[model samples]
Target: MDVSQVLRMNGGDRDYSYSNNSFLQRKVISMTKPIIDDALANLYLDMNHPKNLIMADLGCSSGPNTLLVASELIKSIDKIRLKLGSDELPEIQFYLNDLPHNDFNTIFHYVSKFQKNLRNQMLSNSSPTCYVSGVPGSFYNRLFPRKSIHFVYSSYSLMWLSQVPEMVNTNKGNIYMSTTSPPSVIKAYHEQFQNDFFTFLKCRAEEVVSGGCMVLTILGRQSDDPCSKECCYVWDLLATSLNDMVSEGLIEEEKLDSFNIPQYTPSPKVSNEVEKEGSFVIDRLEVSEVNWDASTDHNLNLSGEHEQGYNMGKCMRAVAEPLVLSHFGESVIEEVFKRYTNNIKVSMSKEKTTLVNVTVSMTRKG
Candidate 1:
């Protein structure tokens, strides 16, 4: 099966769903609010007095986070409209986009309720009419009409490559490009990211109007090293768990050798090069360190390493279980994660695990 056919966040509103496990992603969104606000403010300022506004949230997985993005964008645009004392507010059309396999029905189910809430919050007679629709496809390709979108927002996405590189089999006993991966493996991942990211920008450039803005928050590395501990440790631990299973005759070692994660955490410099090669101008770029256990509730008295390991395991499994299930089959999932949780607990007992996130603000240049 292809990557697009399988990659999706854990669906439905169950306890282990993406909706519940996405607190970390939600934190990424919250931390970048100032950047989002500035980009939207500039977009509104540049538009002057448009009658309608079109926006999109790319990689909008199924969850509260999906609607949270739309709601926040709507609220921000409305505030700008009120501040400018515009005689008439523009009608806003929002496109929520993700892979074809995304649980869009879950988002659609909540649309009416979300719209009703938005309606109640409007305080002015000139309030903008909001329309929300889902666009199912890869963001690496064009999904909107030419020169249509005014603003674009994506959070906790884009670190994902379109697919795992064909040459990834060369990297033995690893699911991602790690410190020990051959230079060829590293090169393959980097090349794939450059290709996908450039394609992404090209597609969006055709869709967004001139002077439009995009604010993206993506998992990235802070340093030039692609195999930095912050970028590769999670996958290293996951690989260790898989290896443990292999040792126990639970899963084939060949399966572990064949599988590689279809994701990359690029450095800021790489991002800059891709943007420069595309149709946008970088307005702002910021990298922030986020603790792996950022979502843990310290107040819950979950102080021990075991509890911390459990929390981290749940979070990673929610985001990654779908892909792992597709590659390794469902039978080994529980055992795999069981070992994964223990590995995390042992690691957390030693030192803090922090992941670097990159937030980029850009404008589509004419």
Candidate 2:
């Protein structure tokens, strides 16, 4: 599949759009605040308090959280400057990047408002202005000039592969890795992730200035086992719904078997790839758990009388609809996710909680 052309969060400002339903993603960003802080502090120290900071947030899906990462990073650096008793904050050039199909227009519309909010948050009156722009391309390919970026940021994005594994055809009856999947299926996912992540590090190594840092948060697993509960269980639960639809003649069985998510849940030990790529060193690696249904509104983005399952269903729809729509077509999407919501409720009843995320802070080797 041409993932760059089709895979995207639900675009536009509908109730089911990623913009409205991405509270969980926002929460992950907030959850890693200290790591961002640490990265910024180290950046200043390692780079000798540089006067200009050039940064990019890869896979910056549109929504409130779109600019939230940029705003928070700017604020963090300002505090770092103040703590170091600097007279002025560094000038910032921030680029927001994602695939061609990402809702760049939505974020473009919000930039002016984001600028206003950012100015209000700064404590220092200095000429260090921040410029924001959108760069549309696959990060899997090179997206920036060599040694130009001072910091690279990504959250909940690296888990997605550049493309579905070519060999996944053998993993019939599952959308992703599962307990029922053969070892060949697991091997295929592992190889794809290794290639993709190594490519990611190699490209960033060329683009980031020596000593610059990347603070990345990706959905991951702690166990080496591919079928670890926290790994692709959420996706497995989603696939269960599609399978049910297939059983009921609502969807074709062959259609469900042919589909595979272009995603991989890597363990923190993927630093092996970083070392092999050999341009960056891991500074801080931490794994944390956030509930699958962590939002304050269990009703999700819906208005009246919704529950946890309904909300999760909406949230997953926001993130996964585009991919599923590209695969199964729009005809059965509603019924599939409706069934997905029920599956989520059942999983929750059995104490299926938490999404495992790995946060790794790394610096380009000088």
Worst 10 residues of 2 by lDDT: 296-305
Give each model a TM-score. 0.94, 0.96
Instruction: Please report the candidate that would top TM-score against the real structure.
Output: 2
lDDT of each: 0.85, 0.87
The sequence of per-residue lDDT tens digits that candidate 2 reaches over residues 273-352 is: 88899999999999998887774454436455465566677888898898899888988888888888788878877785
Instruction: State residue 345's C-alpha deviation in candidate 2, in Å.
Output: 2.1
| Candidate 1 pairs with clashing backbones | none
Q: Which stretches of candidate 1 lie over 4 Å from their true place?
A: 120-128, 297-306
- Candidate 2: pairs in clash: none
What is the overall TM-score of model 1 with all chains considered together?
0.94
Residue by residue across 253-329, what tens digits does model 1's lDDT show?
88988889999887788656555677889899999987878656454676555376677777788888998999999
The clash tally of candidate 1 reads 0
Q: What is the lDDT of candidate 1?
A: 0.85
